[model samples]
Target: MPRSFLAVSLIALALAGCVTKPRPPSHLGATVTVAPPSKADVWQRVASAADAARIARIGSAWSEGLAEARSRGFGDEVKKEALLLRSGAALARPAPTPGSYSCRMVEIGSTPKKKVAFERFKPFFCYVEVEGELLTIVKQTGSQRPAGRLWEDDVASRLVYLGSLALGEEDQPKAYGEDPARDMAGVVERVAPFVWRLVIPYPRNGAKLDVFELTPVTEQPK
Candidate 1:
């Protein structure tokens, strides 16, 4: 063969070998590790102190108003005030004490072995008290703001209490429904010193339930 032709063929063969060589197995080769998703990945922390205060104020005001109306014999005025409080412009609550906590809703994947997935229908807020019951506020609809009426209307928020913590039980709102008497049962487990998990049963049978991992945005000294 001509020298030039021989050289060209050698280069071609080398290029072909380079192109056809199999890549090393990824497990045996250098690999990139990905961190698994955790509660932090899904749950959003509520950082707005003002928002927390506002919710607190609304709850307080509603309680006060209800008591006053009952004492003064002001019928329907309590309802009127509740309506006003919910529809009126924003109002601020007093600053939350140091150690108070607030939480925001987070989206997460459905549990692995369930036939159905539970859908979170509204935004939720949790307030941790230093010495009393833990307060939770859940909106009935996306349009509802964190106001007195929203608190009053939602059974979940209105009835949430930490009394079960003493008994080592999960506290949830009273389940009220038709003949079958559907109610939500929840269990609270401590994942860490500052992290907790809320496990609630799905309303429908054959559905995958979701567990909410809660992290405190504000931690008070014990």
Candidate 2:
């Protein structure tokens, strides 16, 4: 073979060898790579199976706590709070103006970090005047996917029970009267990003319900 051709063939063979060889895995977690070339060569052992199990447990605990709260007469409070947290007080209960308004929690997304975090969703509502001027309002909440559905074996099925329990607690007096939010306020505050409340509005007219979301004002950046 000619010297130039021989050199070219050698380069091609080297490139082929490089291409055929499998690359080693990185030290990062199972997420493949955090930086560029975000592809998985091999799943990393960032967290143990136990860790995943625990993470799942945390979500389960949250759901359980919510259920317990419902059983404790905080049903309206919890749903309203979820709505408030997902939406806002202004839109949630409104000012109780003569114009009738009805609001409810559309979605609740929470992110439970080690110390602090957030969960945001939407509070969808329909407000109408006695005269029949109806309006539907959908408010946007912040971003935070909190851990709550760990035990939800069936999202759709459990949601029915959850919806009934979370939203409707009229017959279940014991569940409706207990204040789960108030009971878990301290625990939630310790782990949650802000001060959480399980507010059962005064007078108990049952016409209005909500969970008041309160966050301590942080020092503004200079």
Candidate 3:
């Protein structure tokens, strides 16, 4: 592994997060101290066997998601954001700094027999927090938020996200496996300078791919 990537990744905290906890200030630029991971990788240790299996097929999800989106007439739009939509556009140093971020969601490809192929949601606020040797990215705004941790992978350019949705304003997010219906899985990759995206492929909801673009915010909501 490259020294720069390894330095950032080795300290990335992984696992799920809750809304009520008093987490540290996740501001950007400070180096965090992390306990070394055990012999088994973090994802392999924490992810449910079934979800792990699904994430393993992320490659297929991207392939099919793009194909269906184009078939449904979103080819032009998909082509427009090639960097964010492309499956292999991941850059190095997938570890994200702990901080508040501006997040936007865009969906591509409709499920079979569905006509709603492309969709975009207004930008929202998300947060990245670290605890132990893992990092959690959770949508700080929006009633329906996905929260999960980033785990290292052999692929090098991306980290696996295993988390669940926090429905409503007060409901705590179910852990990645507590509720099979709400489980969410994806890959977190840096697509550009200080910008990262979480791509949830083969999603069970509105579309095939749920792409969320995340950029750190200088000012956070009070």
**Global Cα RMSD, each model:** 17.6, 19.4, 22.7
9-111 per-residue lDDT for model 2 (tens digits): 9999989888866556765435653653211111112222432343334344445445544554556655654433321222212211222222222122222
Highest-scoring model, lDDT: 3
Candidate 3 residue spans exceeding 4 A from truth: 1-41
Better of 1 and 2 by TM-score: 1
Best by TM-score: 3
Lowest summed lDDT window (length 10), candidate 2: 155-164
How would the candidate models be sorted by TM-score, starting from the highest? 3, 1, 2
- Over 44-70, each residue of candidate 1 has an lDDT whose tens digit, in order, gives 122123323333344343344344434
TM-score of 3: 0.77
Alpha-carbon TM-score of each model against the true structure: 0.27, 0.21, 0.77
Ranking by lDDT: 3, 1, 2
For residues 61-153, could you state the per-residue lDDT of candidate 3 as single tens digits?
788878877887889988887788888889999989999999999887776667778887899999999978989998888889889988888
